[model samples]
Target: MPRSVLVTGGTSGIGRAVAERFTADGAGVVITGRREHLVESVAKELGAVGVVCDAADPRAVEALAARFDTLDVLVNAAGGLGAAQPGPEAAELEAVLAHWRADLDGNLLSAVLTTTALKPVLAPGGTALAVGTIGSERRGGSYGAAKAALAAWYAMLSAELGPRGVTANVIAPGYIAGTGFFQGAMTDVREQALIAETHTKRAGTPRDIAETVFFLASAGARHITGQTIHVDGGAFTTR
Candidate 1:
């Protein structure tokens, strides 16, 4: 029998790849994304169920939970860089605050809100993995701070859920190349500098994180919880 898994933000990059990986492994995968068309398209392509929901909205999250009765895995792959606020009446300080707020909501609260909504339906001894960034420990913009919050929240959740046989962990990635994650933000020097930091001298890929997630969710990782595993090609450990 295939285990039922839910992956949020499953239309792109890390989330899309994670969804595919689970499907390949014979899991009954359901994915969610904000874009209804893209979500539907990806679902059709991958043979997974896709729901349209914004993770930041409580109602939407609650609705998301209503879709599942029991979940074997919940991968919170819904995070990204926060940007400056958009407003004409906002002042300078408020604009700055907006940037942080955006990041926090995008990178941190998505997981929190989604997980909280799904708590009742999570299968016992289930596995959960959230995508984090090395930025939490280094120069990750305001987005990093949000990811840091995510890690801490997972620790709290793990403490509460551990006895129930549910495991939650974070996978912090570094320098993932070829994803819209960079979105052409990198100058040549910046890209090279990142590559230099990794002992492997190679950028990480979505598949790298996906494979690690597979392991962490497997029986072999049953003993592990409340942990952060770096998937950054030794960039974080060495640099």
Candidate 2:
């Protein structure tokens, strides 16, 4: 039988690409998104089940978990930068707190809550993956902080899940294009600057990350676990 896979925030960008990859592989894929219409449309297009869910919401995640009896792969791709916030000097303390909280909830808690809720359903030799960013290594602000924390949390999670034969890891991407991640705020100069940082001299694509994810879920990768795999085309090198 094909593997049963679940991808949160799979309606667009890296998440959508991951879902499509699995769908093409004949996996029994289920994708979740916050918008009903988009989820329905994408599900029909990909021939995969689509769920309308906010992965960060505990109740919604629980409901999502209830639908699956056994899951072979879980990909938490439901996070992004929160709305732009005013500078500390301009914004009130309450506003700052709210912004930070939103980032943590969306980026960190979404993975944590979903993993916890579905832990029991994860089958032997299954994999749990999260989409992270290279920003977590450098000048990333609140968003980066959350991603960093996700890696830390997954270290412990991998230890806990190891005996159960489930692996956990994070795939951190750098300067990916066509993800709307920059939200139309990118300039030619900025884009070139980013591309120059990579040894490949090209922007990463959603497909790049998707291929990494696919490999990690394969039997060949069963020995790999509890690590952050950067897919940045050498923008951030590891020693």
Candidate 3:
């Protein structure tokens, strides 16, 4: 029987890449996103099931869980920087609060809620991987804070699920290219500087992260749990 894989935020970027990888490997894959149209389109394109769901929304996640009963892999790839308000209103206290909450909800809470809701359906020897960011290690912005908390939460989660034969881990990426992450906000100078920081002298790719995710979930990685694997091209290194 084919393994079942669920990837949230699979409409684009890293999520989409991960979903594609699993589908190509002959897994029964399901991808979810907040937009119904994008979800449907991508699912059709990849020949995987697409679910319309907001992972941060408990009710929506609950409904998403109803669509599947058994899962061998769960990839939490739904996260991004919160939107900045336009004009002077961006500096308002309300705007700051909204941004912070949005980061928490989108990056941190989304993974927690979705994983919690689907915990029971996860099979033994399964793996749950959450996409994190190198920003959390140095940059102290709202998104970074949320991702930092996400790593911390995963530690506790690993302890809870380890005995059940599920492995929980985080994969943090830095300066990845070929993604809408920058959304046209990147400049030539900024891109050059980012690449220079990496020892590889090249930007990372969505497939880079996707490949690491595949390896971590493989049988060879069954002994690996409660770890945060950095997938950057030497941009951020541990001492």
lDDT of 2: 0.94
The CA lDDT of each predicted structure is 0.89, 0.94, 0.93
On residues 88-173, what C-alpha lDDT tens digit does candidate 3 reach at each position? 64667878888899899999999999999989999999999999999999865999999999999999989999999999999999
By lDDT, the best candidate is 2
- Cα lDDT of model 3 overall? 0.93
TM-score for model 2? 0.96
> What would the per-residue lDDT of candidate 2 be over residues 136-239, giving only the tens digit for each residue?
99998999999999999999999999999999999999999988787889999999999999999999999999999999999999989999999998999998
Q: For every candidate structure, what is the RMSD over all alpha carbons to the true structure, in angstroms?
A: 1.5, 1.9, 1.5
Query: How well does candidate 2 score on lDDT at residue 104?
Result: 96
What's the residue-level lDDT of 185 in candidate 2? 92
Task: List ranges where model 1 is wrong by over 4 Å.
Answer: none
